[model samples]
Target: MVVFRSGLFFLAFLVIGGAWGQTMATVDRQALAELESLAAQHPSSKALVLAAQGHPVALVQGRATVGFIGLLNADTTPTAWRTWAQAHEAVFPGACRHGVASFRVDANHLDVLEALPMDRLELASRAVPNLDKARYGTRVDSVHAGLDLPTAFHGEGVLVGVLDWGFDYTHPMFYDTALTASRIRGVWDQYRTAGEAPDGFDYGAASLEPWEIQLMGSDTSNVYGYSTHGTHVAGIAAGGGAGVGLTGMAPASDLLLATLMVDEAAALDAFAWMQDVAEADNKRLVINNSWGLPQWGTPDGTSLSNVFIDGLSEDGVVFVSSNGNNGDSNFHIEQTFTTAGDTARSKVQFYPLSAHPHAWGQNLTLWGEPGEAFSANFMVTVGASTEVNQSPWFNTADGPFMLEAVHVAMEDTFVYDVVAEAAHPDNGRPFLQLRIHKGNTGLGVALQMTADQGTVHAWNHTHLSNDVGNWGQDFQAATSGWLQGTPAYGIQQPACGESVIAIGAYASEYLNSQGTEVGGSPAYFSSHGPTLDGRLKPNVSAPGVNVESSLSSFRDGAYAVTEEVEFDGMTYEFAKLSGTSMSSPAVAGIVALMLEANQNLSPSDVRDILEVTARQDQATGALPAEGEVEWGHGKVNAHQAVLAALNWVSWVGHPTLPDNPTGEDLMAQPNPAQERVLVSGNLSAQSTYRLVDTRGRVWQEGPASPVFRIDLQGMPPGVYVVMAWDPELQTSHTTRVVKTQ
Candidate 1:
């Protein structure tokens, strides 16, 4: 029997016999241990512990605990679970197509849920949003400059979806370039519960129309406190040149916004909702994720969230994410042992509680190669030499999960907990996680490790009260044998995923008194990457340094206002912010333009186009063909990328190509013709040919012979459609051809 405290009373649940016992036997031991640790650390909130079940906890209406539950398999629907929840008096929020669902339950009834067969149960992990753009640096201005040809793309007919918080829906930047109408197709506020949720989901308020968002004014406040992050990101991706005269990369694209719940699970829900909206509207969608959590998953991109993003990518939804902003922080260490009995040591530096009020302590995450093991312990010291207390050595091979805390008393008490694992199920790597609490302000912390064989990587991250941010801490070589940390492998989860187009940050160009000049360098804080499994990441780089964009007027605190605009009796503002978060949207907006040019392109196709068209200059210093750790494929080139997209459409067969009944293919020689194209196949003397551009305007129409030549001498360079109608068979065959300059 297990006893759980619920309010003033205690509830006892049986987990020893019958079907309940069998279910408990199959539960993930690591997850169970994590939950037990949380319960022990926070005994006062038994309801919170039960609801979280080792996951991060979010309180709904200040009472119920909400978390995610993964079903046993794809065959198992959430319907049965919903029924079970109802019998146990729990609230089932909704279900996602990936066999995951959200549930809210009281602490007392949580034990009943434990008896149900489940593949996994995850509590939401808190995530911080990454916070762009000099469009000319990426040549996006060239695309917006317009071409004399018919193929002019300003992200028209494409959907740009942003998943972040702090949006001022009434901002003029969300409207059309003429300010005559709103371009925001919809907005889903996951934290607000007073309105209708998006279709197919039971939580959050959904404003499908622009008028609804205008009435609400702003989303509900979150931990960030009426943030301006989401608004700024959106403005950079697709904001019209409303007030600042600085237009986003995709100014003519439609916008779909979602103020997330600051959790991994909620982000998944947002993706599903956005995709559904795009499908309903019959438009291609590109989602920009400017936030990430380093502690949330394995950095090799095999985590559930990474897999989910990959699945979405295959379904035609493109995902772009920020690599991270920890490039300047020395928070990562990699050590290898050539012989037995090799040891490594580093002194942990904790962030002060004064600057970070929610700073609980620091977390040291250590990972070793498969079939290899390592033992680690923490040492507390007074000043530089006096050892106050030393934690017990916890070896990863000893058990799947081990939890212990070290306590010491001098002038004040000092304490910290150690959580070790024999092998993480995700990648079969030996893992160790330590949560060092801020006990005595004067105590010093250090980590010591020993490994028999193989390499190990460790990262030190500052743990906040809500687990929302992954701000790094330094590892100093305080002692003779201690090693100093480096800034390599700083890319976080989601960004490390194979299918996600991770973006790095670079400084944009600006003119100084010394004449036209460019920053033309990687941002100091842009994270470096080559995922743990050794895969090149940060597919491309974009401008992220002090880029100007819209700001939320509803922000509660003081902020530096760079510019302001007055419209309809409301005052809106714009400001400059910097981070990888800003750069991801710049690429996403460019992706919108590519999609506008060719809607049939897949996620992989889009990635290839961006990489092949990326620009490399003196600032990049002759990067390798495979790309570099910091700059990826160098700076993004929007003009070349869109042109490549258009060219690709011609080869893959255009979407507008009509089916031919003649059982013969239409052919054009010198497809990318410089001056003329030879049209042949399935043609007759009585055939009439029409040459049209992308805008559906016929450039040439005339009678054709079996082997005819179409002159392209005066026509502008662009993709053109060629249709030939055979009057004898009363059939038409069409093909797309590219005209080069």
Candidate 2:
């Protein structure tokens, strides 16, 4: 069930954003014509949404929502910025120094604001949801045994951040049983408007104190109760499994929590909140994000979320995200417009992933070449046209009849948005269909959507079949990995960030009968990738299928549980769930162990160690293809990864540097050193030097150095300052060096 922050229904708007240099005002017709041509090639019997490029034009104006803008560097004063936006009738809701801000305006006014000559500003529609769309022990024991790890390495001092839906903080899994104290440090709920927001953040429903959570127990009604996705995810990452025997990968790690709204602006805010908490607590942090934007394919890693991830990565924050479960779903399609009149079209069949299969909606965001104009149509198809299921719009022998249709011409050059939300007239099952007509075709336009929502498949228009294409087995377009071709593109946005460690799922079914063996193959549903930019992902894989973890009070009986136990007079249950969501937290838990081993490991270092220590897989006892697309480096070996982190040296440093002094100073050779950096220059026994990160945390120091080799193997990837002093010259030399690898 897709849940939105209350009171945000009126703040929804379409966001059309491109890189910093793209001209938003320019519209290309040839691109549009090409998309149309691709659409024309598809058959007519199946449902399809024509793909287009351009600013989203309203299909049927229903509601006016809020829009967002990221100022170039946030250089504008609050007063001046508000004045300019107010002139356009845009209401400023919140602003972050990170160059992000939220504003409310009608669709028409938003258009006016978009046309304004605002340099360095990025715009996005605060689109609302269409209502669509691990741990532990038994399987993890194999990983521990494989790596020969010590029992003391239980993620003791590390903090794990969960940027997901609301969590059940009161669960015994998140408390210190001996003292009955909460292990959750803090919570920033963007949906609760009743309390204060976290420091430096102005929005969110409420903030939770650890003590308040301990008092609430199972009274987690402040969060969405429709399902316990967040709760389950958190449990897999760090739950203690108190009364229950189910233990997570890092049961001893403390937690920092935040409940996010579906909006990107809110997500950015939540990221900042968690980072602030981590910094304040002075804890080595690794954050897990299992949620993603559904039905939106942004393989280009230039979205605002990517920007945030990049910025945070410099601060030595580790982020792990799910690769999504669309591996087998037809929610994504990419095809080149080879001929001038050729078209690419598909059937957007909807099948519910929620428990309430009949209630759901899906959103689609299409992108085509610049200056392309494509005609788009959404055709709704229903079951057989009997008395119980009849629709005047569709007419098919097997009962695949159309109920309603909507069409539009996309002239914008960047992104075109469409939503399929109407329920089937007969059975009331949710369905989303599309048909596109491009005037010309020479370039490729890709279509992407959420996988679990339903099926969307491409077919030859002349040979169109009556099949709805919604079956799980046949659903296979929106795969998350890079398409096998030149200029590889296909990492899902947000998760595509360089600093983000995207995780895939390892199935229990793939394991040996003993349940202690590693699987050579990842779960069929785990999204795979060499990102659109050719960056390999997911960095690693972990046990995800049928893993049992803590259950939420609100959803106690919604799903079956494996065990129930009492803690502090309250009953807590352990339930089994699957998906990359489970795999990601398992990795997050392992990261916590890594952090505990070496607090200096940078995000890049964490990713590298995991990949280096990952165990090569031979699915079905067959050697993996040299360039495997799905399994990434390999299945994660918790013991090996942790051991590598324990023995590995840090080579990453922060970005930026202070002014360097010139003349006969101690010079560091190989500025961006990978393993070792040598210190050179005239020096005596009394000469001394020190190397430290941007935060001024010194890592190395040596006395009497005419020449010194500084081991950068222990540093994280980033910029660091080196200070040296010579008693003879009586001058301290400060130089900046970068660490890579």
Candidate 3:
């Protein structure tokens, strides 16, 4: 039985005499009968029947059918569910939080899932990462120079985990500034199956030791091919320059690279793996996600992936993601029906052939206002007045879980599929999907729609045969249509996730060949957003345009190499790329610096500091107090953010310090002093004191008698730690102090 409550729908299935039945069913019987008829004639139609009946079914690896299922009761543990799944020959990858587990089974075994006691099932669509930054413009250079503190902050002791693909483990940029030691701690290649997987997981290969990664050299190519995306993103976040003079935002931070399998469940596993590694090493972790897709979740941030991210945020792990690169694409349209039976129409644009291997159609996703319903149909037109064919109307209310129809017009045949839900279980909005196959027909395609009494929002994306990627296409005002699309609400998930910091892109200021100042405005392609739920996304913007970073030497694809260097008898290359994918890592590197300043900072604390210290200028225009769609809180100010982080630590008291004082609490007078600092506190006699920078490099150490003076002359300004130890009492006390130039 499926019941609608508080705008959301819940499913409760009952079995009668070894057959599945619904009580108080919401599915339209006529639509179901039509779907059944189609299934009998087409092998692909069987998957549609499963979908229309409220069972999530998806094609995995172009062969098997897979989905995620939620256990019915608290008594049914994930362990027991996995056991049952294994007995039925179903592959249970792993269990997720909130009692949900993912399964991969043959198409023939898909029906067996119906017999299990489950509360909800969903299609686990693979996420397409936003692919497509830099230094001085964000004021990171000022922080690196220690302009007004005791020691420079280079994200030392911080772990930067990048979840991306196409990593060259042997890239020279992964080495330290001296080119002697590698900064990468580990690499989890989820596509590799020969070697041992990471502990606590059953798939993929893990390269933990540095020698092991070097032995592998690079990850095997996947669907995206032997790409350079991951290496480039990681370079922007933490590359050590390798004598290339292109320093990343946090050059001293360690790296953990995961070449994801492109699915949400696999992504969750990567996060868990990185967290475990961070915990074991006792270092703060920051994960950079430069990829996302709308199909992974509702734009409102209620998907399982979002829930998992929120949980991780509470555990002190920070997440940063790209807002996407569709700011200039007219891929969205919205319509409101004040009275009953209001209608709207628009032409659907399809990408040119070979844009992608699976680019054979366009997908239109519709979301209606709560408690309201809408109906949609597809029309094939010849020229301006002739209608070649029109498919049946599928209403959101009482529609089949899925419906597929065929229309023949002379020598052309058109096939369209519809997936509808009266009320979404997550946000309670009426959701519908229309996938129209281009079918080698050169004719025109358009969408006709009507709503009974509410507003509906629709987004058009290139529909790939593999059901991955979310590249958008335009919707134009056709001969008989008045509605056209706009480039708004373009932020993708998990950037839309409530706790994740979504970053936008802006071109760093530079001088043109004419000697005129240019740039410093939002990148035309940076995704815009005040998410569907009216929450400001792109928490802030960063430098992303024409940003120079490292390229993978193992990449098979041709690239425009900007510079080349010979390191250790091998030539490495660098190149410039642009997209929100670039801007996201710039912010992730800044977050690492903030964490270095105060290891106790939460994800929210990091976001607040970044926003409060963000800079607004002519490029961003005059921004409101709450931020805007394109620029968010304005451009990131790394110098101010680091200062604020230090202040935040002071206000809350350093987490590493002892709560009670034992006449050993250390304090420094005239902190941020230019010439000298007088160290005095509840110190014991014969105590020895050492002044060390954030990087653990000791500046001065000597025997003390409760009070001493340390000269700050010739020392770079930044944050530093002062520690006092009383050997007689076997006690030590530590506190932080700042120095100024």
lDDT of 3 by residue, 386-476 (tens): 6776666778886436655556655676666667777876678888888777677778887878987887888888766534656788988
lDDT tens digits, residues 658-732, model 2?
343444245656534578877776776688877877566788888747777888886676556677778887866
Give the clashing residue pairs of candidate 1, or none: 132-582
Using TM-score as the measure, which candidate wins?
Answer: 1
Instruction: Give Cα-based local distance difference scores for all models.
Output: 0.76, 0.52, 0.75
Deviation from native of the Cα of residue 573 in model 3, angstroms:
0.9
lDDT-better candidate, 1 vs 3 = 1
Indicate the worst ten consecutive residues by lDDT in candidate 3: 7-16
Q: Of the pair 2 and 3, which is ahead by lDDT?
A: 3
Return the TM-score for candidate 2, rounded to 2 decimals: 0.61
Provide TM-scores for the models.
0.80, 0.61, 0.78
RMSD of 1: 10.1
